[model samples]
Target chain A: MTGIEPLAVAAAGLMGIGLYGFCLCRHAVRRLLSINLFGNGVFLALILIARRLPDGPDPVPHAMVLTGIVIAVSATAFGLALVRRQARTRGDDET
Target chain B: MTALDSLLALLLLLLAARCVSARSLLQAIVAFIVLGLLLALSWVRLEAPDLALAEAAIGAGLLGVLLLGTWRSLPLGHGNERIPLPWQGLRPALITTGCTVLAVLLTVALHQHPEQAAMSGLAALDQLDAAGVDQPVTAVLLNFRAYDTLLEMGVLLMALIGTLMLDSPLPRDTELPARTMLPATLAQLFLPLILLIGLYLVWAGAYSPGGAFQGGAVLAGAGVLLILTGFGEGDGRDGWVLRALLAGGALVFTLAGLLLIPVTGAFMAYPQGLVTPIMVLIEFSLALSIALSLLLLYTGTPGLRRRGER
Candidate 1:
């Protein structure tokens, strides 16, 4: 009923959508995109929760999310590298 | 619910769904970028300006560039075969249904427990004076849980090493045709602008939402642009200075933390009045290291060299 509640619901919905895509998508690139969407959904929920604080926005969750963002990017970069190597190897084998 | 919040939330949900459902990988990547921007807006609405800036820079800007670059480098139109299985659709439906139910239950429980106070939040807030920084998020990062940051830097280094080890030997240099998509004049005009913005974000991070990660990502984007436009090549080997730049952050942070043992009697503890300066130094070094690391990752190489150079 509140403003925050709707955002939470929307984030939940996004998470569900992301989960479905991750499960169904066979392409590594598409799966990467799905994983990021899933991450963004979780971040939305965390940020919304941070807004519920009274005096000032909660810094702890903000910090946690910042760390999460960097870690997510790192993991995605690693995954992308893996995908590229796999593709290159597959191409080489076919040749 | 406020009209604006509802609108933003709806926009985010739509973009997120589209990102997953788009048939073309390129279109899906673009949609994912839009979703990241909307998520940044959502973070801003949540009163987390720091996270908003980070999401905009790293999440949308850098990640978008990385995805596009990777998409370009791969053999095109090769991986979109739809699987033929009788239970394919049913499996996803069941999984999503279960996840949705669990998420809803968790959200309900969290909402009901609104009165619970976060102890870590309280502790960090209480120790603001000792942190020598006015920003609580920065304090939390560089002071309260600095050990986590240290380990994270290690993980990034390991990933870079792994990528280098896995990369195939460089192809022979051929006179490749120039890319017409990005004009030289346009690139020259935009390069300085991107550099300025990256520096601004890094410098502004002390009191605001901008920080090393976002700034580093933006810097890496600039590096990626240079490589794409032929100003630099995505060579897999780096010279000594480049290696130093890549290792500087972790090196400085680790050494600083180690040096504190004698003066402050604990690891990673800055002297009573030196926290801000120390944190800033560490952050600057981190920004540079992270930028270089991500750029190298995009290149899928251990090092970068100028075109035509061995």
Candidate 2:
């Protein structure tokens, strides 16, 4: 029974905390932050797996994570834009 | 080293908990930003310098600015109100149990370490000399899986378009209550160096731990700094040139892959002697488009103008 890697434990902890936040937090921005945290956890896990290959660190997963990071940022930006638009519309309707 | 890793792990979890549960929105945002920086550090420790660079620039730096800006624009006390959780008593206990079980499963699966049939990393290493890039990650991205990279550019472009369609520019404070010369002076000092480093990162990707994505994010950081200091602002008009810069990366990538089919008899396959130059051209164009796209997203506008420009 080998001990689990510390970083791997951290990665799992992040996912759990993110899940808890995403479920409990009511604010859109907070939920988004939780989602991003969840994403960071997944990326960390993939990176750790990449380190486990026999020869050296795997380049394929590295490339994939890079692509994933850019996509995640873009997606989050778009979501933030939606949040802003929703708030504005709600304000307009109230007035 | 193990002890240090354990400490970092503990710190990361603690910060993440704080980010989600902090009473003030500002405190939560600050905690998230610090968490991102720490994640970058962990990436470095794990031997992924390229990921570290990208995570710091894009994940922490750019995203932090965007989040803070959005927070500013939201109605006062928007996120501060504590809405009672659904099924408050049973839900939290259930959620905790579920998440804990999931984590244990993931850890156990990772330990299993199944054998892979075709080890892509080893294969990429074997063909490094012919891949036209000394960096294996670069080789994988621009050569072996070039199609995926091209599609990613399309995804980025579409995301920008969607954000534009939202038509919600972050509300800006037009008048600075205490306008100072320090920020502008600092921006002036650092802009050239930032630009140089960004371009160098793109060039260095062929043989080192830098590439279009990381380089573009750094360049976008430069744009962010300018805007923060009032040297740059979003303009209402969308010029033809701005459109071109935004779309050029995918256009060039698609055209390169299509046109080379006749010469190499396979899509995206660069001829042997011309691989390096072709990759360099593609990389720089990608970097340019990416940098501009990210900058536009940050500004939440269609076009950009320097301060005091008519």
Candidate 3:
């Protein structure tokens, strides 16, 4: 296997593991972690592709991935808010 | 074929697996942070230092704190049960087979026909020197395709707004109480140093890998630490100024870009000889907005204020 290919495979494996974790984890927090794992896996794939660009490294993909990181964190923050709200409402209901 | 690349890739894979597989949420969060660090290393290997800095700061550091804070607030032993696989025996095999086939196809395709040359990127590379920025990624992000960056700033603002809408009003005295907390002496000693580094990163972004996003995340970490240690609280709900700062980056960037339409005949087009200054302006605003947004997200409140305030 070539250098980039292995990284790609490993990233794909990470994606699979994240998917499995998401499927089996019931806790919303754990599920969030799993979803983040999935995101990192996609990021890994993008970096792998970035490595393969001929001549100078592809700046476009690098820029896109940087944007992607910001978007991912924003989304994760939003997801955390949703989780907290659900937990709070559930607790209120239980009490 | 370098040993460093192989070792880093191996470490990344192991950490990625552990992040998902760890039984303890704390362990998983730690592993996830490590995974992000290793991923940063991978980006460095790929010759993407801009991404490396971003992955380390935002991906590993700020996100790690957010995850840990959320874990702290959740009730203990709430998510301990692991669900059994639905198909019992056949599912694992099927998944493995499907994955293997997909991997093979991808590998074959990548090996057979490499990606076509990015024509615009090549053009950008040719004109990079004229853009007055030493870093290609920054030039691309702000100069070559600034519309995307502008839109991304909008997405970030929208996300923060969405989160605020979903969260309940901040508790009176929403600052965390000083209950059995870790010794924060070290944090106090290091806070100024970290803030200095964050500012340096933002300033250096024009020429190097460090930029607004990473610096903003570091700044947010500082705010998070202050909140955790009972030094401050999420009490800025009535502070319209705080909300404006949170929205300032996008608004300023958009307005500045629009203002250029008449003079430059294009949105976001800087007047000749002023591109770098314009970029710096946009970046600083972005850093403030991003930091405030992330801090507010963690606080789970509309805003924050000084401790003991109304």
What tens-digit string does per-residue lDDT give for candidate 3 at B272-305? 7888888888888888988898888777778787
Model 1 Cα shift for residue B278 (angstroms): 1.3
Backbone steric clashes in candidate 1, count: 4
Better of 2 and 3 by TM-score: 2
Clash pairs of candidate 1? Answer: B50-B209, B236-B303, B237-B303, B238-B303
Candidate with maximal lDDT? 2
Q: Name the regions of candidate 2 deviating beyond 4 angstroms.
A: B81-88, B116-118, B177-179
| Two-chain complex of model 2, DockQ on C-alpha atoms against the true structure | 0.69
lDDT by residue (tens digit), candidate 2, A36-91: 98888888888888887677688888998999999999999988998998999999
1 versus 2: better lDDT goes to: 2
Candidate 2 or 1, higher DockQ:
2
Residue-by-residue lDDT tens digits, candidate 2, B1-310: 8898888888888898888878777788899999999999999998899999999999999999999999998898788745233246788778777877887777676666666733777787789899899998988988888888889988889888988998898777688522276888898899999999999999999999999888999999999888888887887779998899788888888998899899999889899999999898889989999999998888788989987686
- Model 3 chain B: which ten-residue window has the lowest total lDDT? B168-177
lDDT by residue (B1-310, candidate 1, tens digit) is 3677788878887887777767778888899898888888877777887788888877887778778767766788755545322245777667767867866875675456455676778788889888877778877887888787777788788778777777842232245434444554566678899888888777777777677877887888888777766667766556889888888889998999998899999888999888888988998999899989888877778777765566
Residue B295 shift from truth in candidate 3, angstroms: 1.1
Off by over 4 Å in 1: A1-4, B81-89, B168-182, B307-310
Model 3 stretches astray by more than 4 angstroms: A1-4, A53-55, B83-88, B107-116, B168-183
